[model samples]
Target: MTTVYIADTGVFVRCGGPDKSKFQRLRRALQQAGVSLRIPQRVYQELGGNPAADKYPSGDIPYADGFEDGWIVVAEELDYANPLVSTVMDEVRRFIANETDRDEDIIEKADTALVGLAAQVLDTGEADHVVLLTTDKPAGRAAEALLPQHGFSDSIEFRYVSVAYLESLTADEFW
Candidate 1:
């Protein structure tokens, strides 16, 4: 079964500078696994969104290189017409808001897009399964808790890509 891996911004940031061990480990693992991480378009923008991020050692070079090496790719646009996807996204938004204790308006669609895209992908038969890699606690729990209720049992999994998670990754993970 094909597994679609969707990653959030924290994954990139956690990799840090070009020479960091974490960055090298993630790069080697992905290259050896022949799997590129998918980032939502909004996440794509968020990664390079800050003009001030360049000053930090954890910034710049590495991310551009990750793209050049093909370890990062932007996910396709979501289809608004899918009812299951739409319903799931709305539910995720509420779940995220409740989980984070944030107001509804503070939770943007992009915050829920990783889960929505996964639902849409499965609903459209685009993939056999999905693994969401994120640092957002509320969003991760939202995906893990909700998708199965919509009848996508065992097809979706959320992985919290913390500072340590990708630091020791290997091709075995992809296999």
Candidate 2:
């Protein structure tokens, strides 16, 4: 079964900064495994949309290199027209809202996009499995909880990209 790695904005944001060690580590691991992390268009936008974050040290990431090196590809647009994709996104929205104890309307589309993309990948036969790499707890939890209910048990995984996780990442993780 094919396994696609879907990453979030927080994962890239975590690798940002003047020190490129963490970023370099992740790049090497992905290259060694011959795998790339696909980011949703919303995540691509979030990575470059915030002008205020440019002033911060962690904001000075060389993410463009990943794209140039072919280790970071932007995922195809989310197909809301797909019933499964739309249903999963809606479930994710409500799950995240309930998990975070906030209004469903307040949850960002980007968060739901992660799971929605995963659903799309599976429904369209793009992949049999999905590994979501994100730092957003609510989204992660929602994926871990919801995907299984949609006949995707053991087919979806949520991996929290913590600082230590990135620092010691390896090709084995991808395999």
The clash count of every prediction, one per candidate, is 0, 0
State the C-alpha lDDT per candidate.
0.78, 0.85
Model 1, 50-132: lDDT tens per residue? Answer: 33344221333347777667787666667768888788889999998888888988897667888888898788887888988
Tens-digit lDDT track for model 2 on 82-173?
88889999999998888788999999999999999988888888899999999998898898898888898898899999999999999999
What are the TM-scores, per candidate, against the unseen true structure?
0.86, 0.90
| Residue ranges of candidate 2 with Cα displaced over 4 Å | 17-19, 49-62
In model 1, where do residues sit more than 4 Å from their true spots?
49-62
